[model samples]
Target: MSKYIIIHVFVRIFSNMQENSKDPITQSNEQCSLTMVRRVAAMLDLDSKSFSEGDLLPKGWHFFMLAGETRKSELRSDGFPGLGVPIPDLGLPRLLLGGRTVSYNGDIVIGSVVEKTSFIKSIVEKTTNSGPMAIVTIQHELRPISETSPAIIETQTYILLSASKASNNSEKTLSQPIEAEHQKNIIPDETLIFQYSALGFNSHKIHLDRSYAQNSEGLPDLVVNGGLTTLLLTEYIRTNLGLEITDIKVKHIAPLYCNRPMTLTAKKSETDWKLYVYDNNNDIAVEAEINVK
Candidate 1:
């Protein structure tokens, strides 16, 4: 039987097992400063010269500033906060950011103190062709400390890997290169990864140490920041399409390594849009949907 069918069957069975039993975990409210925003934009090589204090933060930049887990002493060798966040144990040794959606409800200023409340939303165990893995859903809501309403809510999932190493057969699942004509391409180099990692204060070694990623994590090369790709699509939607975004939904299909050129593609879908990012090899790396009004 095919892996997708197996995954679907198990997902249907386990869907109910994962439910709302856990309490919400709230982190100390963190301050959103202009310095942090500009630093992130600069690291992503974005044009932040005109950025000001009270302007609404562009899409995806929130990943850099909000919901920060501040336990430095708990970091694993790989730089992940080993026990910092409440991700379900798949008995897996590896973790990857699968994708996320940011729904904007309001705005925040540079000096605004924002409160972050997060919880473990769900945990779905599936059998992949390579092995068994778990898809852990986590939700975070960010609001100004002074306001009772949330400004943005981010829903993201993480892929937990069971095997200590990535499987070679999994590489065959890649589809033919995307040949879409109307798309913009951006080159991601090692430096970009460095800047982005710093901007997000990410301690994950996968983005910085190519050797560790290749040897320890079994990745082909340095993985670009998934959040960066997400924000890029959001920014493109804002500037090129002139869309006023209300919601974003995304899923990571594959990894795009440093030194690869990523192609961004989007098409209108009713009042919304479907977007994709293709890696240098032409495989769709990320799939996304943007709802605009």
Candidate 2:
């Protein structure tokens, strides 16, 4: 697909994006430095040895080191990384990825160094179709280590609530009665979880350590990275639809664990496609929309 066509589609998604326009955001930043990008290439199963650090980082690869960590070394029983930043103690224990928006300025080429400045854009207590929840919105801007122009900007929202909170995924369960126009069945394994964790610089033990996940966190299985599921959605559009994705926004609905049958489904709309991923239980794990004009 032509670049111009993708740009037009991105514009439409941006127009309908769920972002609050407010001011005086809490700000802090970290360097996209070190050989981190190299590790990122390994996580993606890409051979960066042949490519230099200054070379433009590939699309969909911009999600590296997005979660800047807290200096403290301890973690809550649920494993929310103690990134020194102050996350509101919403009095909630569990964390779910609500949604995210990646505004692609261009391929983020990490020169000798790069910088990512983040902002606590907003935090709202709201009632969703599911139940009561606290939504935390964080914004990240990526640019050259010494430049002012941004190569990319991402607005990521996290939802904090009780683990036992009700979800409609199980209530409206379907064995995929309607055949999807396009879909991919992927049974993710521990190896994919490990590699993706390595790629995204995610150190959450719930994702890497199976015993810790089940014993400590009280989870049935090792958790899958929300980012990886979102990546699958974009890849489905690219490889299956022959479209270039400039933006991706997703609201995770349920948890997806390893060794389960997970399927990605997409259906066509007027200018975009209704996208989703289903867990082994056949409940929607993620709810999303893709725009490819």
Candidate 3:
């Protein structure tokens, strides 16, 4: 059969799963709101044109978190290893992705609409085995405009730069100094690292499968994805930076492995805030700057 036919068949099978899932992500006190679900879906369906018309649930805007003027400026800065600057790109490290994560924290029952917002967190320039890399992050929050409790929606993202654009580096050791406004520790272990990798559906050898990563990627065991670290830092800002995060940007500096503990911090500058997911030994796992309303 043609690939399209196979895809159509798979779509039908997944439709049943959605129908069968009664309150897929259980709510604390109330039944899952159908109205809220529709609202989320509608927002996801909106486009740039509708966004220009007015507020349409803030969908595509989140994708811009990975690209912007600030991100471009930082890429051209001197902290990076290469003599020349790199291109500013968007989307996941893996282009064709499985959409964004929808971590259901609470349900906005049917007939209810929740307010949504997003923000750019921070940007960092780092030298990796592949050369200079940028990990941009965006934070999103979904809260009922009215009395909504025990149910909240939140997500942070990490985007990797294309490997081809990385400075041509045959050497694995990063030869650059990472400047930081704040200091943090990186304490990683098997359990925390493994759990995060699993939740993100990341099959990259550098994340799990230690032997392959060490032999092929030439890393210690398995290296952590900067995107996940940026997500964690973006989450920190959502919980602390008030309720008006509209965008976020983050960059990756160094690699973090399992069995290491790291410190996460957030700072503000005017309407923007910076978050750090830093490692004590290797320096920074990822640095993010968030824009708040």
Candidate 4:
């Protein structure tokens, strides 16, 4: 059958399923664990002693609170836990982090209990030249038990694509180098990738299993977790610029592989700050805009 006909049929089938299925919403509670915060600091080679029970949890560090507890048997074939929320089985096997928007409304203190509410915000099915694909948006609200209002709100978008053959590395192209006011370079190794994945309770094979990444996903090596990339950017701004972030929107343009050096650059404008993560080949892998106080 022709690709066009296949996509058309798939779209009709998905539409029927969409009409019958309802989006899922879930609520949970987690402690802003001081131990976890110290571990994260140690993982980043920062002083673990710097984090304390009463200290405010750093912005973007709330990712661990949203980690999904999906059992092994219930995990998706791709090994994604869906960030603690149940994702509909849309018949699409491949998943990628398209981007995320995060708003910091207040502070979450270490050792405080947090109430988390997560729900699917939107799902759209579309046809692309590669094949039929779906975009899923999930939103999470985290409020400290002591406060009535949410401390942090985050929306993450994922791209779901039909299974396909492994990608060819030779087809990759480099992006033009970006000019920035400040920049830092770091090589994300297997250890860093493993630590971040473990902390977030993420078991995605693309970030953990090398053979699966190369043979199954057609990637050159294990891919870096997109959340980790965003965390690093936030830390850079926090430490180097010493700015307080109110909001951020990030986009993952390309994948950054483990063991490869990636440069993080920031440019300050009159309004907000722009950040970019350039892969080893000088390709822009991630882009973000930050609004600060």
Model 3: residues >4 Å from true position, as ranges? 1-186, 239-244
For model 1, the superposed segments whose C-alpha errors exceed 4 Å read 1-24, 82-84, 88-90, 126-130, 168-181
Best by TM-score: 4
Candidate 1 lDDT by residue in tens digits, 190-292 = 8877877777677788888889888987888888878778877887887777777889998998888888788999887676788999877677789998888
Segments in model 4 whose C-alpha atoms lie over 4 Å from true places: 1-22, 170-178
> What are the per-model C-alpha RMSD values against the true structure?
4.3, 9.7, 17.4, 3.9
lDDT of 1 at 263: 91
Q: Candidate 3, residue 132: CA error in Å?
A: 14
Cα lDDT computed for each candidate against the true fold: 0.74, 0.67, 0.43, 0.87
TM-score of decoy 4: 0.91
Model 2 lowest lDDT segment of ten: 7-16
Model 1, global lDDT: 0.74
**lDDT, candidate 2, 1-293, per-residue tens:** 44442211111112212255333233445444436666655554657585575676655666664765544465655656633245546677667677788767655555545566665666677554555567677777777655667777877888777656233232344565536878889888898888877666577776888887777556778888888888777766875778776666788877898888788998878876788898887778898876664
TM-score of 2: 0.74
lDDT of 1 at 226: 86
TM-scores across all candidates? 0.83, 0.74, 0.41, 0.91
Best by lDDT: 4
- Candidate 4, residues 70-179, lDDT tens digits: the string is 88998888898775577667899999999999999999999999999887777788776788889888888999988998999999989899998556553456667756
Model 2 accuracy (lDDT, Cα): 0.67
